[model samples]
Target: MSVESKTNAQVMTRVTVIGAVVDGLLGLLKIGVGFVSQSHALVADGVHSLSDLGTDVLVILAAKWSNEEPDANHPYGHDRIETLATLILGSVLLAVAGGIFYDSLQRFFDPSVAIELGIAAFAITVASIVSKEAIYRYTRHYAQLLNSKLLMANAWHSRTDALSSIAVLVGLIGVSFDLIWLDALAALIVAVFIAKIALTLLWDAMQELIDTALPEDQVTAIRAVALDVPGLRDVHHIRTRTMAGKTLMDLHLQVDPRVSVSEGHEIGCWVAASIRAQFQEITDITFHIDPEDDAEMDQEGPTSLRPLRREVLECLRADWGPLVDDAQIRLHYLRGAVDVEVVTSQPVTADVLKSKSRAVWLGRVTVLHPTVGDN
Candidate 1:
């Protein structure tokens, strides 16, 4: 889905607020319960939950700032704000994972350590897992529905927390089987999961920040939409970028050479409207209308020959016949040459004369009739 309207801001606000409240309460509950029951794993899990609260703030601020409308200074709107926000969320997760790994490593080396597990720790761990999983599922569902990467990153962050609590629960049960070191191992496992999530988010954001184009299939679809327009002959040089959470494109559109400029512009309007109707993600499109593509245009060199109108008349009169002063000749400066359209005074051979003029100027010339001015 694309950013359809400002109503997305309302949806974002609702989700972030719910997440913040739940995470904060859960962090406090686990920390308080772990300290009372002397479970280091639960305490670390609680700290991770608190750390997620920071990312919640990132989502809120990003959602607010990125929704700003386009302005004179920033004509593209504020979309990249969300991209940078996702980057910061990934960075925070990395720092959190580093802390988890370092603490676990220290505990792994120390020989003298005492841990006491109470029934309350078990209850807290199970509750943490179930609650955090609920949060993850809720956030992830909407993130995919809305196609929001920022929201999706936060969802994974929640998922890691849930998985950490599950590890803690398993480790607590392992200690029952006389495997006490499993408790410490659980922290290391949590660190590994968090690191993977961080790296994935960073890579996705990097791709968007670098202005990557859409996939080939999507580009082909865009071309098809353009070509389907009534007056468009071909579409090429299509490039795409995402701006403010929507697609923007610029492409060259081939049009009939004989069409008037006003007609070409009218065709351009239809092309834009048709594509926008076909692809909801597209917010802006730039159409560069061409009489022909570059390869075909190369055949017409130096459109302007610097021939004055007086020189054209003198050439026509000397080469063909006396020009009736009232004959209409229209010269169009094109590509770098002048195209001629004329109603000739000579009745017998205007087509041959027009063809000769076109060959001389290296441009198109059309004689109105085979009969020229008279029978």
Candidate 2:
């Protein structure tokens, strides 16, 4: 997944390298023993083990490349490299499974395909089972510690090898009783397990590549966290997606319309901080500060079209004349119009108010004068 730290990446690399070495030894030993004993099931299991070497290399490369810092060209970082590697790993498994299945089917139909087994085949299968299982446990422990889904998937892949070896072992026992078909059957079963694991990995990687949203419960929790912030009037338009197990989110945070820009920004920062503190998976957050819900305004009519401050001020100066020049003007763009508030220490009669009413875009204008001190 997101190998944000060099230490985690090193752990992933070391684990995968160890698995690769083990896989190489077991793959060769099993294949050699299968040839000597004429056991197709052991051969199939050996092929599966060999396939792990390829994926182990893939994992090592992915772990290294995916942990790279965001560059000028790749601003989102290299997380997707790990995802792509996973997809490729799945495809490799599927291909290996298909080959094993075809070979097994041929052996099943051709009774001339002699099958034999002995203590060597049994010993190799047992050794593979024990070794692969240990690797699975070791990799899975670090996967959970680092929160790396890719590493965990590899761990399960190792477990599948152990399971397939068990199937092979059962077939070996059947061969001692002169049951030749059981070897082919065990090979077919191993193919099925590999295919199942492949399909699962492929599905998960595809979902991530397509930018699927996080689970509903997690999104709901994020929304709740944002709403809990004291200065937030409302939070909406919350969107979330994951990249290599890290979540990235964006949402709109509504605040008092009259609040200063700095205050609204501060509220957004607090909301982001609270969510980050609660959810460790969230890696990025983008907040859109909103004075009012733009969705609600759209229901009545379109309110997006409005005059800019420069145009509004020019209009005000033209209509209110020199009285607007000396006045402190505040313009609020809401509900398809501008609400102007003029604060000045000058008297304003009905005639002056009526003069500024010519502009249809102006909603209301309130004039205020300085008051004398009473105490």
Candidate 3:
């Protein structure tokens, strides 16, 4: 694969490994403390952290698969694998949140709960806060640096865990005051926050999976780059979308018809290269070249074909120079009609010159080769 793909994979791997290690440790600590202190809220928070471990694993798997090269089955590569994994992770979070909320509601109605506060539960909560906050900052730093939606989602996931830990801390303190309902209330609040984060992640992932167009500002930037090419006359049909962690684009660019095929191809390559150089997110591009007409605007008669023929001759003279000596400009006044011819000193191969000449005449010229001595 490409250097870019390798680098992204390495970064993702590091983040996922860190997430798994930290979350596993935190989950074990919370579960241990929760069981010792008989705190339902603390236990629920532990379960939440445990779920994060699963998400980290999924991230690692998705990053691995999403870096695969394009194939017949997936012409755009496996970028959407990341989106699919994110969707699954979000759904899992929603389910966990729902379960916690259900349990909290049960406690709310039954009110048959034991209030227990201990040093262990409080220490675990504080540790969770510190660890999760640190992970949040670390993950967010890389997320922004990589501009990865998946990493950002994971970072916010860490934030949600931290928020849950804070709720556990509050609940544990309330239990010390003999207010058991506050513990259940805190659990409910934590569940709500998790649900919110899950919904946001789901929405963003769905947008990417459906191939939604990028923001207007980015689309405009792509067009600006394409139009800046030397021979390009106009740009249209510009499109942009996110695939996996990168941007994919396609556009149609107008150029001078007199330019050779290789020159036109070079212009397309330049436009693509410029976009890739300017924007790190752009990973692929395709452009169509359209030729422009100059002399059509110089003529006076309405819909006259003479100006087109004149433009063709001028273009041939500019392109072929002394090789084309005897040239005749012809025109048919019928609707959507054009024809022109150039007589050169030697036999000119059609394969080498046809497209270039036709492009100059807007695909309306006919070149005739006369006897060399007669010409």
Best candidate, TM-score: 2
The lDDT per prediction is 0.77, 0.82, 0.75
Residue pairs in clash, model 3: none
| Model 1: lDDT of residue 125 | 80
Candidates sorted by TM-score, descending order? 2, 1, 3
Better of 2 and 3 by TM-score: 2
Tens digits of per-residue lDDT, candidate 3, 93-198, equal 7886797688778767876753357888788889988888899899899878877777777887888778767766777787788777886898799899889999
For model 2, what is the alpha-carbon lDDT of residue 198?
A: 88
* TM, every model: 0.81, 0.89, 0.77
Which candidate, 1 or 3, has the higher lDDT?
Answer: 1
Give the CA lDDT, 0 to 100, for residue 288 in model 2. Answer: 90
**Model 2 agreement with the true structure over 1-375: per-residue lDDT tens digits:** 333468878999999999999999999987988888877766866776887898898899999998888889998888889888888877877886787688678878984563456788878989999999999999999988877778877887788778767766766676687776786788799889889988998999899899899989988999999999998988877888777778888888999877878999999999999999999989889999988887565346564578888888888778778887887887776656787878787888545775646778887677767686522
Clash pairs (backbone) in predicted model 1:
302-336, 303-336, 303-337, 304-336, 304-337
Q: Candidate 3: where are CA atoms >4 Å away?
A: 38-44, 292-338, 345-375
Any runs in candidate 2 off by more than 4 Å, and if so which?
Answer: 1-4, 31-48, 296-304, 349-355, 368-375
